[model samples]
Target: MTQPLQIGLVVFPEMTQLDATGPLQVFAGIPFFAPDPGAEVHLLWKDLEPVSTDAIMTITPTKTFAQSPPLDVICVPGGPGVDALLGDSEVIDFVRSQGSGARWVTSVCTGALVLGAAGLLDGYRAATHWAAMGMLDAFGAVPTDERVVIDGNRVTGGGVTAGVDFALTLVAELVDRATAEAIQLRIEYNPAPPFAAGSPATAPAEVVEDYRERTAAYQARRIAAVARAAAARPTP
Candidate 1:
């Protein structure tokens, strides 16, 4: 039997749990995941520390970044913590190293910013939360206005909820279409949001404007953090 594909889901304080957990759950349901052991998922962080999610949830890392197994896939999930992590040299260095070695590198929502900070997004077509799309250019990535964008081995998802779709798509890419479809069916992956405000273009102008305004301060902080990270990196 083929060895299980080792997958790493990176977590940090204040990260959105759904970004990692949703995908992790989907990948765990594949029959081959246990029988043939298609994939084995591990939660990794800078240390084996307990990380909090937006202050509402806490999770413990299964492994430290330095000790994480060589990964077939590495996923980064995002949330408010991204603002702080963007300037963390240890996190950036860990991400840069693992991303370079992994077979596929994936991100959900603002997690793309982490990849950008690690210098992994350069010259790639990537997507992030619509509210943060403009910031992608700052990191030299082409900002794609799509739910999901796959550029070579790097796959990125837009907004928070797009994580499910991203994981389904990744299942097809990494495993097989049959396995992905089965997992989707098992999970009843069809989505129906009660409101149509999920996208900026679909929401009322006032609502969209308000959302952007609310997140403005956070965005400013993230930009400054990314700038500092960029400045501190050794010249290549």
Candidate 2:
């Protein structure tokens, strides 16, 4: 607990914007939490350059791996770019180093795979995007499918949208229930979607099938990347 909680959210090409931004918004607003009234957010990348995301927007890194200060929380977001990240020693090493000292190690969506690749998820029960649930085992993680999953100091959000929930949960843990509720209410973090197509269990079967088909090639590549990363992971 300090005046400014240092939080770093990883950035890379083709990452799901919401995966990082959802948590970023929550962390950025942490000053509103009276109990712990300050939080410094850092967008981390290999360099201080603009990184494109799947949402078509771009995020410029506020800190590079070499320049990043010790973080209280380290979060890696997931997307198509995670495939390359899975095998990226630099990114993996950065995550591993941060996670080793951070109070919280987290991810949303396929970013869990990157954490897994970094040898951080072994024996941990973590959550990720539904499509990547089974991939956790490659990193010795017990696959979970909940909106948010917390195992010790490790916290993971299911998919992109789950990042907000994940961060609020962290707020509650780091600050208090009152601060978290106040922030939630101030942000009007109410969930009332028009359709129930969020999850495969409720989504139209045809829609699920279509999506699976559409992303088959991409998923295959991600799976292969996970395998390679797992193989390269140093045994503990």
Candidate 3:
């Protein structure tokens, strides 16, 4: 790759900022990690406005979809806002258009659903947030249970935090493992959570049940949204 790497990350309302920023942090360190043939990561949206997140803060898009340069990678991040993205043709069309030409198509967490909605993951093994795992089948995707999955040029991360791992893996693909590891070391990407309850399998039964109960309505809405997006997607 003689040219500079151009990576585009999609941002929207109510998205989990970490899903994009986590991987972004890793990708942004490419210059320091391996100075030659540097990278340019663009935060993209339909317009150049500040997008809100699931948290209190908001993120501003660096480029509009129409204004973005050709991207080597197109990555989407996930959160509560993903439900609306399922039914959004503007975002879906943008992904479909850009992904068709990008060297890599990827997502973090439920952002996989957006790629699916764009018909980008058909017949590919992918990963998404645990809660949205079952939705992959609707898009003709094989849902793999892993923190990160790479099937051909399509890379996906399990959830929000997995974005860091996802990008590090992509960096290895773009450059080398040594560079990726150096970036990892630079970031000190160590995981030693205080609790072992991140996943449903490890969480207490009551805690899991309570979460399921709380999210039942949201999941129901998501299912319906997925159905619509799947139906609206063009067949390949």
Candidate 4:
């Protein structure tokens, strides 16, 4: 029997649920898409317990970080929790250790900031939420505005909803483009938004200013968190 490819998705309090679930639904379809598939995905946290999202939703992790076996892929999802995680030693250590050996290290939205916090993104071109893209430079990453950015084994998605795009891209890399397309069709992944304001460039100026003001506090915290993490990194 072919051993399965173990994939771990990190979960923490205040995370954006879609960031975790969107990619999960895509990867979960691998068995149906690939011939003789070999992949298993799990939600990982500090412990096997319920974690809250940015919204009212809460999800239970399938495995604890300490108990997880070596993963072939490790993904981190972002949200308000990212500010806290950027300064969390335990979570950063877990990400650092897993990423060192995983076949792929990925993130959705500001989750790239978490990877950056772990010192995994140095010299890498990564994607993250447009609102926070500028913050990547603090962690030594060159930020890209694309919906999905891939540099070697590191893949990162733009904002919350881009998780789907990130996952499909990863599927193509792991198996074949055909299988990935099949999965995309299976999920009816075509997106047609009613509004054309998904990004800062497309959104109305007033709306962009409002969002930036609303996120100012979180951005401030994130700035401090990234500084702390970067300062703590060991000297080469």
Candidate 5:
């Protein structure tokens, strides 16, 4: 019998809920496409306690760092909380260890920052939230501005909702395009944004400026965090 494909979706305090849950909904549906798919997703954290998200939601981890089995996939989700994780040795260590053995290492939004901090993204062309694209340079990662990017075993997604696309892409690679298509249809993945303001290229000049101004401080902090994390990485 094929061993179950173990997937670990990391959770941390103040992480954006959608970054984690969106991909989760897709991976959880694996059995629907292939009976006995042998896929299991685990919510991983430092402990088993519930952690608060950036929004009002709270999520509880299904496995602690110490107890998690060898996983086939390691997924890190991002939000403002990643600022602190950039310098968190415990979190970085867990990611580094798991990624060494996992078949795939991935991130959503700024979660790529966490993977970079862990030293897994060095020389990899990765994707991240546009606002933080420039920050990837601090960790030796070439940032690509796309909804999803796959370089070797490293897969990354852009901001928030892009997790779904990332998950579907992963599914297609793992199973088959037909299975992925079936899953997409089941989930009704068609998208029709009400406005064209979804990306900076299409947004009004004033809107872009306002967002830059609003996020300036946070972006600065994130840059500093990435630098610190990079400097502290053990010499390879």
Candidate 6:
């Protein structure tokens, strides 16, 4: 029997649950991928304690960073915790270390910030929450506005809802297009947003401006976090 693909998902305090759970649900829904009919998905956190999201959702992590199994893929999901994670040496080290062993490294939403902070996004094409894209260039990454962007071994998705598309894309890349299509069909992955405000170009000018204004503080915090992380790194 083929060994199940072991996926490690890193969860942090204040993370957006959908960013992690969306991809997780997609992968876990694939029954034929493993001998036991269930693929292995491990939620790794700094602590094994329950992690809460900004939305007040919480989940228990399966493993701590030190105890995580070897991973075929490492997925980092983003939320307010990304500000904290960007400056966390232990978390960044864990990401950098495990990412080297994994066949693929991916992020959803501002989780790409963590990858950027780890220096993994350097010279790579990446996407993130539109509010956070400007900072990717600070880490030497080329920012794209697409919902999903793949560059070599790195895959990134834009914003919260993009996780599903990112995971489906990854499914096609790792297994086969047939498998991905089957899963998409099973999940009824077709999307039709009720409103056109999903993208900056489609949103009213005032709404787009308001979003940028509201996120200004968070962006400032992220910038400081990234600068601190970059400065603290020992000369390679």
Arrange candidates by lDDT, highest first: which order? 3, 5, 4, 2, 6, 1
TM-score of model number 4:
0.97
Cα lDDT of all candidates, in order?
0.86, 0.91, 0.93, 0.91, 0.91, 0.87
Strongest candidate by lDDT: 3
| TM-score for all models, in order of appearance | 0.94, 0.97, 0.98, 0.97, 0.97, 0.94
* lDDT tens readout by residue for model 3, 69-97: 98999999999999998888889989999
For candidate 1, lDDT tens digit of each residue in 157-233? 98888888999899888878878888888889888889998887899999988977997898788778767766654
- The weakest ten consecutive residues by lDDT in model 1 span 227-236
| Model 5, C-alpha of 15: deviation from truth (Å) | 0.2
- lDDT string for model 5 (105-203, tens) is 999999999999888999999999989898898788998999999999999999999999999999888777887788889899999988888799999
What lDDT tens digits, residue by residue, belong to model 6 across residues 116-202? 778788889999998888878777889999999999999999999999999999988877777778888888988988999998889
Clashing pairs in 2: none
Query: What TM-score number comes out for model 1?
Result: 0.94
Model 5 segments more than 4 A misplaced: none
lDDT of 1 at 190: 83
| 1-236 per-residue lDDT for model 4 (tens digits) | 56777889999999999999999999998887674666888899998779999889899999999989999999999999887887788998999999999999999999998898888899999999998899899888999999999999999999999999999999999888998899999999999999989999999999999999998897888888878877875442
Clashing pairs in 1: none
- Shift in Å, residue 63, candidate 3: 0.5
Give lDDT for model 5.
0.91
RMSD of 2: 1.2
Best by TM-score: 3
lDDT string for model 2 (1-236, tens) is: 55788889999999999999988888877786663547888999999989999877999999899999999999999999999898789998999999999999999998999999999999999999999999999899999879999999999999889999999999888778887888888889999999999999999999999999999998888888989999998675
Q: Which stretches of candidate 3 lie over 4 Å from their true place?
A: none
